[model samples]
Target: MSNTPRTLFDKVWDAHVVRQIEDGPSILFIDRHFIHEVTSPVAFLGLQQRGIGVMFPDRTFATADHNTPTINQHLPVQDPFSANQLKALETNSSKYGISHWGLGNPKNGIVHVVGPENGITLPGMTIVCGDSHTSTHGAFGAIAFGIGTSEVEMVLASQCIMQPKAKKMRIAVDGKIGKGVTPKDVILYIIAKISASGATGYFVEYAGSVFENMSMEGRMTVCNMSIEMGARGGMIAPDETTFNYINGREKAPKGADWDKALAYWKTLKTDEGASFDVELKYDAADIEPMITYGTNPGMGMGISNKIPVAEALGGGQASFEKSLQYMGFQKEDSLIGKKVDYVFIGSCTNGRIEDFRAFASIVKGRKKADNVTAWIVPGSHIVEQQIKEEGILDILTEAGFQLRQPGCSACLAMNDDKIPAGKYAVSTSNRNFEGRQGPGSRTLLASPLVAAAAAVTGVVTDPRDLM
Candidate 1:
């Protein structure tokens, strides 16, 4: 190890540092490859056409989540498109000799969810996924990024991916988090304050007191939204939280290997005097659970704040105004009392064991609102089983939440599950773009607690109040 102080990113980058070209990005050595139903099909076909195969097949893992149905995993998928895609992923992975964790497999779930659950994501590694939220894996101190279909083919054919170096930004959130606040709120607040484009062209590194203290799930939530904040990727340096989380995973190095890995992982931290291209800071206690009042992720406010006026919206004012008109919302209107058509509490962003526990805590013993339709999907099949084993399902069902099959249900309109046209849905998904949930369906992004609170009350209520 070099005596130079290294950030977690520096450690991982140096470990995977293959070769550097003069004035060009270093050739990165990818450690793990994650596959989902949506992006693997084309990449597989590309490989077939080239007569190539997955170079490091075991390093690649496949799961159908984005388009997999949250209901009836036992039965055939309800949507024809989804059914075909899931089937194709299974076939493609099988043909290529890659491990595909299909629905019903103990490890199957969202690509992002399964990677960490099974210890596939670890410190000092490079990870990539086809989904933009692939940044979620960076919480383990890995350099994780989302890739295009073509690039997926490149990685499958050769474990190395060509990439340009991204400018770096360190977003420091220091201080204690306020009650009723969460990492979800922290990211939402970051996006709101910085606006959606604040980190554009940069790889964001989350830092400071609040981030350092965040749980693995919270760190995942922070990194998950890196893309939304206009960064190519987001990362948090690994600490004891990261090490403990990876200790017992199926793919984690074991025994002597684990000891060896830990020695290396301990070095994955920012040096005290290292300089970054950009630096940002925020007070952790100031953040609160936020809700989107307009079409984009940035058009959000604390659950207590009213919708923004056009003047306060900056360059996106016209777009924000248009989205409000589309969603039938008006400026100065409060979001809490809006009638909700659906409440969705799972996504790559919040569909984890911790997120479910939090949601269940909020809704336990409460009856689901008669007027609200709710779906609670886990991030992965392992998460689903954990929920059942922990009796989380019973608590959820009694409280009027159904435990849906593991998949990216309602987060995107790719699967059969979708909010009907013009209906309002409070979702835990990351994006709030127009037609994100479905054509003309309005989405208000919030944390699982907020979504659960909305489900029981038939309106958006702050969970902090109920808790």
Candidate 2:
């Protein structure tokens, strides 16, 4: 082996490799496996067909998110199909003795959100889920990413997966971020700069002052979008911030165990002089409140800037034109005064308590625009409780907004929260792909602050203007 220093990704990856196949993928061990309703059913079926028991049930966690309705969750799931999926998850979890936080469980919420809150996510571990936003766990310095149904089954049966190593990348953002900028803006800006495929074939580690100073929630928001940039996953080195976030979590280690874990966690950082296959840096000040104007996350611009002229787009003119057409926009159109029909302020990307606080902050003294329908869904039941306990719900209610129950509402068109056809929505979700929120629906991905601004103004207004 070479005597080179190792990046955080390198160190974590190396420690998790069970065995190296000759000229092939390594047998990588998974320390934690998270499952959700949308993808776990097939994997669990495969296990039943193979008559295999889960190798280590304690290491696996299951939750129902994607298909669960945001409201009326207290009653039976109204949609039969969604109910079936949730039932399947519960059945499989029970059959396999895996810990499950089903709908209405106090612990139930988005898998990504629940994992960190419960401390199921930890530093120096390998974490995987069937959802692409599994990168959210990487914010705690774990090597986390999404997997396919087959890979999920493999992990369930064997606690390991065959994986080729990914190249390492470092994205460093320095300097002070300006007021009104949130972590969602930081990621949207990065995707816009690098394009959606910029980090293909790599695992990125976010460094520099901006990420270092970011809150755990903020770091999670940034890492949650790593897949949009085509990176396998993204991570940040564990620090005091990470420890503090994990310290008192429900599932976090206790007493002596905590001390032992803390010592190891402290060591989970990139070594000095380590090299990456690729490196990119940006000034945090250069990033502002951002919004996507096209069908892709990379098609974003600062709230103060006009949309790009078609001639300036990277993809072929035909596709670029098609995307703009889908969004009912023309090249060089300014989004500033564009009418917005809906505002969504919840997702795994921005559905935490922090996100709600940001939304409430913007709309505290303002009324929701009558023309704009706003859906404020939290990511989990815990977050919902926190919203009420913190009086954020009261602020939202006084602002003419209702707090919806927790679920992955409107982030995708999977359930009852879909946007109507041909309507425009400013969403805080990770994706802005055509029809992602609903058929014929147009989504503009943005931060919770930006979405809040749109909710109160009925237009794409700069959050800074409201501030």
Best by lDDT: 2
Off by over 4 Å in 1: 1-6
Pick the TM-score winner: 2
Clash pairs, model 1 backbone: 7-269, 7-270, 109-380
Q: Per-residue alpha-carbon lDDT of model 1 for 416-443, expressed as tens digits?
A: 7888888889999898888898888899
Tens-place lDDT per residue, model 2, 252-346, is 99999999999998888888899999999999989999999999888999988888876675677888889999999988788998999999999
- Quick one: RMSD of model 2? 1.0
Give TM per candidate. Answer: 0.96, 0.99
Alpha-carbon shift of residue 365 in model 1 (angstroms): 2.1
